[model samples]
Target: MPRHVAIIMDGNGRWAKQRHLPRAMGHRRGVEAVREIVRAAGDMGLEALTLYAFSSENWKRPAQEVGDLMGLLKHFIVADIDEFVENGVRLKVIGRYRELAPDIVALIDDAVARTSENSRTTLAVALNYGAQDELVRATSAIAARVAEGSLAPADIDTDAFADALDTADMPPLDLLIRTSGEQRLSNFLLWQCAYAELWFTDTLWPDFSRAHFAQALAEYAARERRFGGR
Candidate 1:
């Protein structure tokens, strides 16, 4: 019953390596996992699911690989948008979307618009996102407001600062899952995950099944989240 769950879909490259398949093939397969997870989350009555689709540092990868990733994104949008709209699933693309290719940006805008009124579920895809960069950007916005006399420096607090972050509209993060047995956050939703339960698994992104997701939720359900209290 996590109100909001975020996942770092890791191990695409490693999965590809293990199978002697091209890296792009792994990325393509990862999209199938995304579809499965989104469906599972909605069926489970989850409020929101935020996926770390691409990070800011991912641009450091090879040009062909990046191109392949973008191509896969485009393919997913085109192939699944109709189903998303029909199922009442809202699609949100967060992070530096303006930096993407114009066509991709247009597709994202279209998908978001088409599902704007959906209430069944919310699926947020974080592309070109970085936690530190998001924090810096939020701080800069708050500073600008203070300098403009629209806000007082003394009024800044955790809630006020969180409002400046990108996830202000979404529910507070309740669970964070990292696949491929990774245990690090990797610059994803740092502000929102302050109190989220953490889960890790060795299943690669392409291999992550609904059973694995259910197991993560089961483990989360067994925890006692007292916030700061004992």
Candidate 2:
């Protein structure tokens, strides 16, 4: 089984449009997909699951839509916290958390703290996350350390860079799935997905089911993960 599975959840708005429903409705339905996939991943013995919930660029969206997303996230916290614990799923967030509203940050912190002890599966949500920002932040941290005489520039290496990332505690990605017919990473996991298998599908986020997830896993199982080997 794959140790870590990362997903770029896309097509919520488009899915809603196709059904003549408001985009908020699609986002609401997409939340359910998150629940299903989290359980499906746990049942499949995956140790870590990382989801691209909101990107740094998502701020370009309209104000109302962004507000709705933030509100939906709060609702997700209220609804999923107990279920996360009941399912032995650990909740974690990796992103530029300081940029979020205080209330949302508090909710996320509470969720992370409450589920810290769960051992069966780990669910990591990437909120306000962007790979480029993570790299820039890490670089700034390294520069500060060097300026403080606390570290030497030559000491930096791949592991050093990895340690500086927000996802330092999580396992490296084994597989990356992008749904909604998208075929790009869009600047995710720049430092961690060194050798992850990639899967893309036309299935939109709101309509993404466990069967689609399973198909991605099945495809992953069929590949040769040489990690640059012959």
Using TM-score as the measure, the top candidate is 1
Q: Report how far residue 108 has shifted in candidate 1, in Å.
A: 0.6
lDDT (10s digit) by residue, model 1, range 14-119: 9999999999989989999999999999999998999999999999999999999999999999999999998889998889887999999999999999999999
Over 88-175, each residue of candidate 2 has an lDDT whose tens digit, in order, gives 9899898887689999999989998999999999998999999999999999988898899988989988888888888888888899
Distance from true location, Cα of 32 in model 2, Å: 0.6
- State the weakest 10-residue window (summed lDDT) of model 2: 163-172
Clashing pairs for model 2 are: none
TM-score of each: 0.98, 0.96
State each model's C-alpha RMSD to the native.
0.8, 1.2
What are the clash counts of all predictions, listed in order?
0, 0
Error of 2 at 146 (Å): 2.9
**How does candidate 2 fare on TM-score?**
0.96
